[model samples]
Target: MRQLLKFELYKIYRQKSIYILFGVLMLIISLGLYMDRESEQANYLVYKQWEGEITADKLAYLDKEIIEIEKKMESGIETPQERLLYGISESFAYQLGNAHKHEKRIADLTAIINTDSTSYKERAAELEKNMLSKINMSKFYYDAGPAQIIDMIYTFGFVITAFLIIIGIAPILSNEYSSGMDQFLLSSKYGRSKAITSKIIASVIFTLSVITGWVALNTAVSVYTYGFHGWKAPLQSMFQHYFAPYPITLGEAYPIMISMHLLAALGFTLIVICVSAICKRGLLSLLVSGFIFGVPFAIDVVFEDLENIVWLNKLLKLSIYQCMKVKEQFVDFSTYNVFGFPVLYPVVTVLLSVITAIIFSYLTKWIMKRKQVTI
Candidate 1:
């Protein structure tokens, strides 16, 4: 077993495919970091300028709006919850209008300073504060915090890792047939069991190494750019509320979310490798694997709004998204209630995928033993 494992590791090291995958992962991380850096710096500058302008005058104006909202609630025209909802709605609406006004105000201030203003520094400071206030308002509605940004960066990085894993393992079994080496490997004394096991171990090691590398690279870059203080934020909630109708903060759920992501990626890689082994043709394996993964996604997209149709809704709900237990974490929605219990889509998906992969691996070995190698 040790000898077999060593041979498998050596084979992986000799293969150029592993290097190619590593290069791609590095490229993706570099580009993503560069883009994020520019965006975050600009946002930070705006924030700094706004901090200087938060004064008594601005507070008084904001207090007037709050007073009006309270007065409406005290009139007994609506329930407290209803009044609170209305107030929140009104606040968002006002923010939208304020954004437009703020832009125009900045433009006018710039023109005045350029033409006749001797108080250029003071005017610039005020305008910067105004811009920053707009940024803060926007942040409330959308995820602009360091944690959210890191999450997004990590997601993209993971996607790159997935692509590499799929490509790396696509030829695991197929290349043996293509190069007429299958017979030699299978006919040896300990061939059938040992060779197959070695290949599996190699594929697993390669997949795990790639995942770890990409995650580490992304984490390092994120920390350098955004700091490392927001690690406790609930990853699941943050992802679910990414584009949700009602945004929520899951600041306390980050660890579970990260674990789920890692599990999903590992499960997905194993399934793809199993498919590659079963198909024994790189192109066909890739296509079949892609279809198996994509068909469920396409079904969800087409029938997502048919929840009113009981059977269709149930079928859609049972998709790999729900099966994986990370669907809620990865998808945006107003609310999620599944059979009176919260759906753990990521966990379920990982479990199901792993089971399926194991079954496929056994089937592949069984089929290989019975078939004649003709290359």
Candidate 2:
């Protein structure tokens, strides 16, 4: 097993694809850092301009808005739909209160309100209600200008790492068959079982090494660019338009987020490897893996607004994003209630993805044993 693992590692090292993937990941991180630097400078300029004039006045005005919205909602004249709409609007408004003065709070708020066509009076009322709810719900008001950009970069790493792992492992079994190496190995004394185990182990090691490399690169870039001060802030608080029912500081949420992300990457890589083993063609495996991963994203981009399609939403929800928690960074809000426990979205997502990967891998092994190789 160790010998096989070493051979696998050597193969990975010799592959130019590995270095190319690493270079791509580094390029992405560098671009993200550059963008974050520019964003920070811009944010600092805005902060200096609004240092006093806007800060105090904005907070006070937010407080008044919250009070007014609560007062109106307490009147109990609104329907459940109205109340829900109010809630959504309020969440956005609260984010605005915490937003830096130069963050285009008013324009964003107006855009949210204008998204739906309603009577002028209704629009005005909805805007007011939303503003208040947002102010009241906002638990943190710190600038995330550069930090957010960094998180986005890390999030993209999830995709890149998974892609690289597939590229690395997809050819492991397939190339052996294509090059007639499988017949030589299979003809050996321990060929059937031990050889397969060794291949599986090697694939796993290669996948994990790639994952680790990406994570290490992301960590180095993040620490260098953003420092590590606010990692404890609630992951939920980083969102701009949605609010968690319970306040969570980034300090409280980041560790779990990171853990879930790692699990997701592992699970996704395992599934891709299994696909490669079954297909036994690198290009074909790559295409299949890409489809399995990319189709969900394509659906999300095209049909995200069709909220009435509950089944579609559920299906898309099961996509790679669910496993990787990538959507958490983009979506403003997510509800979590399972068996009366307030499960975090990322935890549930990783759990489900890992479970699916295990099932698929076992099935792949079974199928491989049953199918007779022609060579």
Candidate 3:
């Protein structure tokens, strides 16, 4: 089993396309770093002065300073330092305003609960519970570094990882057929079980490596540029996720998102491997994998209003796009009604990813076992 796993890994390592794709990833990272060079340093220095627990006094000071800066700007005598200070103050004030929005959201949900509709009441109660978790956790910090990393991972980084997984693993099984090696493997006593398991394991390693590589490079550059100042900060500190319902800090959310991404990638790997086994042609497997992966993203993009339909929204939210870009799961208060219990979307996504991987692993094994040599 060990020998077979090593051999399978070696075959994946030998794929020149994998190396080329990795090179592309590195180049993109380099270009991104160059484009954003020193652009955020002033923010970092300014935020450092304000880092710590946010107080009413700090808020008042920011408001007063912002008004004064505006007056100076109106007079056409505002200096660059004052301009930077105004931007920083606005960022802080805007992020802090989400707390008021969150309060209003909770109150709206409460009003619904006051009414007499049981179904709407239950749903509103669940959503209120989710929103309440984030109530007092919002605090000010220099969170740009972690925010950029989280955004990058959930947005562009996962796209690259997905393509790498598809390009690398889609051919794992099909190549064996293309080279006429499937005959001996299927006819061997241990081939159906051990060899197939080893291939799956190798694909898992490859998927993990690809995720880790991109995450590490991205984080290294982001932290180096942004000064790694906000790991302990609340998720609400970032304007993009100011209303995020997760109670966890950025430090906690980062690993959870990565784990979610890994599980999603693993499920995707099994799917590509299954396609490879069934298609028995490397190029055909790649095309099929691309279609399977791209269709969900395209559908979600085309139908923005699907979120208004409860059932369609749930189904689409669980699609591969949501799985890979896991931030959407945490950015809002969404719940799934499971057997009269309310489960969070992140929990449901994790469960679905694991279930997909298990089911596909067995399905791929069954398909491989039923294969027969053809003339």
Candidate 4:
């Protein structure tokens, strides 16, 4: 078994497709890092610059700074520093206003969760309870760097996983027949269970390695380039403003979101291998995976109104694209009930991945067992 596993791994890693996948993933990491840097400079650099010594107690600090700039303008002249400050006054004001608005939202949500816990029906009540668990209800300092960038990188990182898995693992079963190796493979003494098991194991390792390397490289490079200053900050401080109610910080959300994506990739790999086993054609498997993964975004673009259909929307949201989007997991207006308990979207995504992986694994095993030496 160990020898067979090593042989399978050797074959997968020896393939030129693996190197191509790595090159593409590294390219994405480079591009995403560059974009995050540019985005930070354009969007949040001003807010971060003006956030000096500001806090909940110093909520009026930005207002005072604005006043100082206004008083300087009263002199009917401006220096370069004053001109810069004046130009950025509205943006600075907006960040301050956003901070105050965030505090208000936290307070309101906390009150509703505590006082009105029982005022709703099944899903809503479950959602409230779930939200309550996440609400820390404490005043937090504003952090204006990296949160938005990290969110963008985490999501964009999904593309690497999905694309690379297709290229690397789509041939797990398909190429055996394509190269006329299926007959010799299945008729061997260790053919039946051992061959299928080794293939499955090989695909699992390859998919996980690609996902991990992509995430680790993306996060490491981005954080190193941008500096990890915002990990301790509240999620609400993010540009999305959608995840504000969740009590998790960027630090907590980062791993959880990445885990969801990794599990999603696993689920995708399993299904693709199953398709490969059935069709025994790598290119066809790639197309099928592409269609399955791409369908959600296509729906979102082509039929925006279809999301309004409750069951259909919930079903669509389970796809790898929807599940990979951490922002939508929290902010999107969808709730799923599991065993009568309302599970958060991200949690639901992970659970669905696990379920899908299990079911597909069984189906793949059955298919392989029933597979004849058809070359």
Candidate 5:
């Protein structure tokens, strides 16, 4: 079993296509980081200009500054500096409001996660304790700027990771059949159970390595360009348009994205493996898996505003696209309740990924048990 697993790993390493995918991933990361580095420093310029203007560290000073600016505007005479002050003040006010909302959202979600019992009385007691355990999240004054989180996470990370996984693992079993190696392997001792088992383990290891490489490169570059200053600040503080009430910082959000995306990638890899196991030709397996993975994205683009076709629209949220959209899903205000618990949108994706993985595990086992290699 160990030798078979090593051989599988050796085969993957020997594949030039796998090496080429790694090169492409590095190239994309290099280009993205280079392009964004110069523009990233500009956000800091504005932030520093006003940094010395205000002496206080609290949000109250910013509020007072806003009132003073409004008074000056009322006189129908304003200076450039006053306008800048107003803009900065409002930005601070927005962050303060976002932080407060996030704290409340955290408390609510905490209560939801803490309740394990189905009894109404136990749930009621926990709810009261939750209200009393409210955390005071006020001092969130940081101008670390937008982390370019979506671009790094989805465009450069998730897409590339998924493409490589499909390339690397889609041929795990199909390639054996395509090259007529399956017949010999199945006829040999320990081939039926041990060899197949080794392939499954190898597939998992290969998939995880791809995901980890993508995520690590993206994260290292992003933090290098942006710095790790606002990691503990509110997610909204970094992206003004992002108003998700998730009580989490960029620091907290980073690991969550990694975990969720990892599960999602594993789920996709397993289904592709299942397809590869079933199909006669490796190319046909790739096509079928590609179609299954792509149909949701196509629907999302073609019928994004499709309110009437709600069920069809939801198909978009159930696939790789949803996994790629880690940030949006986390912050989405949509509440899905299962047995009275308020499950977040991002969590729904995670759960679906796990469920899909389990389902395909059984399917793959059944296929292997009934395995045949036709000449």
Candidate 6:
């Protein structure tokens, strides 16, 4: 088994296409980082001066400074220094304004729960619970880097991993059959079980490696751009997560988000392997796997405005796209009613991924065994 696994890993990693895809991915990431226009250094310095617990005294001082800056701007002579200060002031005010915005979000959800049909009442209640939990979020910190990294993981990272898996791992089993190696393999002593088992394990390792690679690159680039600050900042300090109900800091949420993404990607890799086994042709397997993986994203783009249609929207939320784009599961506060109790979307997504992996594992084994017998 160990020998077979080693050979499988070698075959996977030896492919030039894998390295090429990684090169492309890295180039795109570098381009994105280079093109970013924000003066993160200046922003960081300004935010650092006001970091920590946001208190009334700080707000008052900021209000006075903002008023003074506005008066300077109102005078027909404004210097670049004044403009920069004004921009910083407004940014701080906007960050603080998120508190009021979050409160309004909670009140809106509460009102919907009170007036909506009983069918949606449970979901609304869950949203209310989540919102209320973070209602007291008062701390502020320089979290721009962490926020960008988190957002990049859910958006670009998942897409990159999916394509890499398709280009690399999707051909694992199908190429064996295509090249007529299946006959010799099936006739070997350990081929029927150990060889195929090794392939499955190898697929998982490749998936995780791809995910880890992108995650590390994202973190390094973001940290280099924005500095290693805000690990202790509350998750809500990020504009994207202003409504997030979790009480954890960016340091805590980072692991949870990556873990969820890893599980989802593993589950997806298994399904792609299963398809590769069934199709018996490399290109066909790639096409089918891509379709299955991409359909959810297409649906989301088409029906984005129909989220008010609860059933359809909830069904879409269960798709792999939602699992891959995992940030929404945290920020949006969605839930599933299981056995008359509300289960958060993140929990449900994790459970679904695990279940998919288990089911597909057996199915892949069964398919391989049946194919061997026929051959």
For model 2, residues 71-126, the per-residue Cα lDDT tens digits are: 77799665544444344345345455455431354455566666755454335434
Best by lDDT: 3
Residues 36-134, model 4: lDDT tens digits: 556544444544565443354444654566677777789966665565556455544454565565556556656666666444434454455455455
Q: Stretches of candidate 1 above 4 Å error?
A: 35-150, 153-155, 233-252, 294-327, 330-343, 372-375
lDDT of 6 by residue, 25-94 (tens): 8898778766343577866676777677777888788777777777877884676656756665665666
Which scores greater on TM-score, model 4 or model 5?
4
lDDT of 5 by residue, 1-375 (tens): 889899988876677898797897698667856646555565555555554323355456667777878988999687766776677777666655665665665576567656646544344435433433332234444444335653466555777777777778777888988898879767758767777777778888998888777667766776677765656555555553255545566667767877888888888888888998898788888788888767775776687576588886566666666775565575445546567655567878888889988888778877887876555
| Sort order, TM-score high to low | 3, 6, 4, 5, 2, 1
lDDT, candidates in the order shown: 0.56, 0.58, 0.81, 0.68, 0.68, 0.79
lDDT of 3 at 79: 85
| Reference-based lDDT, residue 110, model 4 | 65
| Per-candidate TM-score against the hidden true structure | 0.59, 0.67, 0.91, 0.80, 0.76, 0.88
Deviation (Å) of 182 in candidate 3: 0.8
Worst 10 residues of 4 by lDDT: 136-145
Q: Model 6 scores what on Cα lDDT?
A: 0.79
User: Which number leads on TM-score?
Assistant: 3
lDDT of 3 by residue, 92-206 (tens): 6676676677777777777777674777457747576566645554466777788888988766777888899888999888888889989878876676889899999999999
State in Å the error of residue 3, model 1: 2.8
Q: In candidate 3, where is summed lDDT lowest over 10 consecutive residues?
A: 129-138
